[model samples]
Target: MSEFKMEHKNPEGLFVSKAFSQAITVSGKAKTIYIGGQNATNSKGELIGAGDLELQTKQALNNIATILASENASFANLVKLNIYLLSGCDPRIGYKAFQEVAGLLENPPLVTVLFVSEFARPACLLEIDGIAVIEDKD
Candidate 1:
């Protein structure tokens, strides 16, 4: 068993979403992992999807998953996610794509979706960044 604990909550007054948690309280010793913004790009830095929001969203989520694995963690370890969508993009597409992969997580993390005019890469449709906490081994 692990000493680290996390309490996820979605109060009655708040909008409860299957996609994400409203809040999370972390306790005990843990290691915090800060993941950088990831877009729909392959390991070779080439865009995976062009002019396709759903595909882009999935690729970005896959990138995040890869990062989490590198830290000896998974989606369940995520505490928060900041999602940036192109200003004119449809968020529903992104949400659906996320759900396809996020269904594996028993406790999804708190999420914030924002509309941005542009990203560092012009071809990028969306970007995702995450923060995760893992039980401290050291």
Candidate 2:
């Protein structure tokens, strides 16, 4: 199988930042992984953080990590991420936590953030989902 290539770009007229890419193009043989929404829920199905956006965001990111690892992938394989926070919540807290946990990637994935009025779980402060791609070794 041929190697997969991921090209991260920030076009000339667009704003660029270390936090995320404006766009990413993947080519060649690859396996795509779609991660479902994850919150602060732990392995035991118990909420890990309540009323704390930072902790909740970190736990959600960690949950995503576990899912990625199960498929032999990591944060480096991620191409896109969607984060949702409860309305009226401070996003800076969530962003800070994500940086602390996920750290900085050489090629960070494209990210989208939205504010919602509520979540399925009232105690939940945030949720995250992601898409990743990896070379097909087959």
Candidate 3:
């Protein structure tokens, strides 16, 4: 089992994800895996469910999943999730997506959601960036 902790907190945090914040202080392997910002697109680079935040959110997550799988990682190995929204995503949407992702695994990773002005792809209603750690299957 891995241990998680909270090393610091932002002074003006309005709604910091307690779970995610605590993960910042976790003690684990010196080695870590980083996932770049994954937009709402498929491996084929096709836009997914354009103009729909929920659909885009799902596709972006799918993209993230693929990335993890490629590295022998799973959502259970996820320590943090950083979400970027292009607007229209209320707290409810965030919560719902969290549930959806959690539902995909036996153990879900902590998450943080931040609203952004825009994404590189205009059709991207949402994006996800995160980190996952897995025991190297040597």
Compare the candidates by lDDT and give the number of the best one. 2
In candidate 1, which residue ranges exceed 4 Å CA deviation? none
What tens-digit string does per-residue lDDT give for candidate 1 at 93-135? 9989988976646788999999999988999999999899999
Residue 124, candidate 3: C-alpha displacement in angstroms: 0.9
Estimate, for each residue in 1-138, the C-alpha lDDT of model 2 and write its tens digit.
367898999999999898899999999989999999999999999998778888898899999999999889999899999989899999889878878987888889999999999999999989999999989887
Candidates in descending TM-score order: 2, 1, 3
Question: Listing every candidate in turn, what is its Cα RMSD in Å to the true structure after a full C-alpha superposition?
Answer: 1.2, 1.2, 4.8
Q: Candidate 3 residues 5-115, lDDT tens each?
A: 223333364545534443334454433679999887887889988866667777777788788888876666677888888766665665566568656444445677788
**Candidate with the larger lDDT of 2 and 3:** 2
Total colliding residue pairs, candidate 3: 1
What TM-score would every model get versus the actual structure? 0.94, 0.96, 0.72
Q: In model 3, what are the clashing residue pairs, if there are any?
A: 5-22
Q: Which residue pairs come into collision in candidate 2?
A: none
Q: Using lDDT, rank the candidates from best to worst.
A: 2, 1, 3
Off by over 4 Å in 3: 1-21, 24-30, 104-108
Q: What are the lDDT figures for the candidates, one per model?
A: 0.90, 0.91, 0.68
- Of candidate 2, the 10-residue stretch with the lowest lDDT total is 1-10
Q: What's the CA error at residue 7 for candidate 2, in Å? A: 0.7
Question: Candidate 2 regions off by >4 Å?
Answer: none
